[model samples]
Target: REDPSDAIVLKSGLHLDKPLDILFDTKAGTIGTSSLRRIAQLKQLNPEIKIQDVRGNLNTRLAKLDDKNGDYSALILASAGLKRSDFNGRISHQLRDNWYYAVGQGALAIETRVGDTFTLDLLKPLIDLKTTYECLAERTFMQQLEGGCSVPIGVHTSWNNDNQSLLTLEGIVLSLDGRTKVQNKMTIDLNERLVNANIDDSSCPFNYTDIAINQMSDHIVVNKLRNSAILGYELAQSLTELGAKRILDAIKRQ
Candidate 1:
């Protein structure tokens, strides 16, 4: 974050290559939204996945997934968690890559006081500009759509294959049952989006006067970030125009 609150968000990371012949999970709150989206997506290609509310930490859950007598076929999990705990090798029959994860899924975040220069200075060097941009765009989409656990929105952000400077955002809205789908994507030249932009003092909404923009180099970083956020907004607009709102609204009503 240019200022504070969110210096990071869940990011996609390595996961086990575990095969997906079954489905189960350690139930939780907001994170479960991603699980719902996963189940909704995977059910389309495989037989119905078993959804159960297992209680436990990563260890307990994996134990259940590995229990020989257990009926669990698969356990929905954050690949980042698996990787962080050094259990990525346990993953199999992956579903993460075959479809978009939720906005900001698996992201890592660092939080600090709004004007804490000391903390900001210490953390600034750790920020990855590309990952920062990607998270910002995804956060923007989720924010614009007003999507939550009930709506089950999906999004993916990546750099262009041919040109490293270009970024593309793909968003999908799926019914809880996975029968209905509305998807759209937008690509932008990350460097080009700012050419005609009004780069004034008001350019970056999250501008940290003392930290992020004190130097010209930091100013440019925030500028690129501001433009990346707009990509999410623009993509949300495109999605709404294509009846994504209707799909979400209907899901909400249910």
Candidate 2:
């Protein structure tokens, strides 16, 4: 299961309805967008509210938030991380609306020596194939676009497991100031591709072989993966055509 992207953790007794100052870590692009988006939205409502950056691990950050004398009235954090640290109670609001998650956010990944069948076998049962497919599309989009921490790029993906599994991807490129953004969504019927590739629907969880180890080969399943990745590449191309590249390029010169 994918965890929610990011959330607002307020000081004890603080309310979301109340005006407040916010704190966030600015080093990581994923969390940086969270802060910038909130700042942009809040500026429209409470022009005087403050936002500042304070970097630390989950525990250290929690210590800062719990300090009564802390300057920040609230904290923006990954809901998944907060929960993992056993501080879910501090989360007052999950930020999703008008927010696109970082590519592959909240998804777990394990990397081992290539061709390590032992590790692969151990991890195979825990793998969520649907999430894998979704993340693959997002990562492919980022890789092809050459997205990096400096570029404010994000994506959200959903998989519908109906009679035909359909994958929907929404991607965005934003200006540093957060005042401008280009976003687009695309959907592809992945089940159709799998069917055409002769992959059985009964295979509830596709074997890892479906993923091309390095590049395309004789495996029919590899084509299915390639098609799914192509969907993302196509979406990125459409967004670039709609001026995403210009926006990204302008940001880079800064």
Find the candidate with the highest lDDT and give its number.
2
Query: Between which residue pairs do clashes occur in model 2?
Result: none
- Per-candidate count of clashing residue pairs (backbone under 3 Å): 18, 0
For candidate 2, the lDDT comes to 0.63
Residue 32 error for model 1, in Å? 11
| Cα lDDT of model 1 by residue, 1-254, tens digit | 22111011111232324333223222211111235666566555443544555568878776765565655545566666666778766545345444777666666667667657687677766866776777777877777788865566888777877887788899888777777777888887767545424323354434411124223356666566767777877888888888888988887788
TM-scores for every predicted model = 0.76, 0.76
lDDT per residue for candidate 2 within 47-113, as digits (tens), equals: 4445666677877776776677776666677788878778888777787766676777776777677
lDDT of 2 at 17: 61
- What candidate 1 gets wrong by more than 4 Å, as runs, is 1-34, 194-217
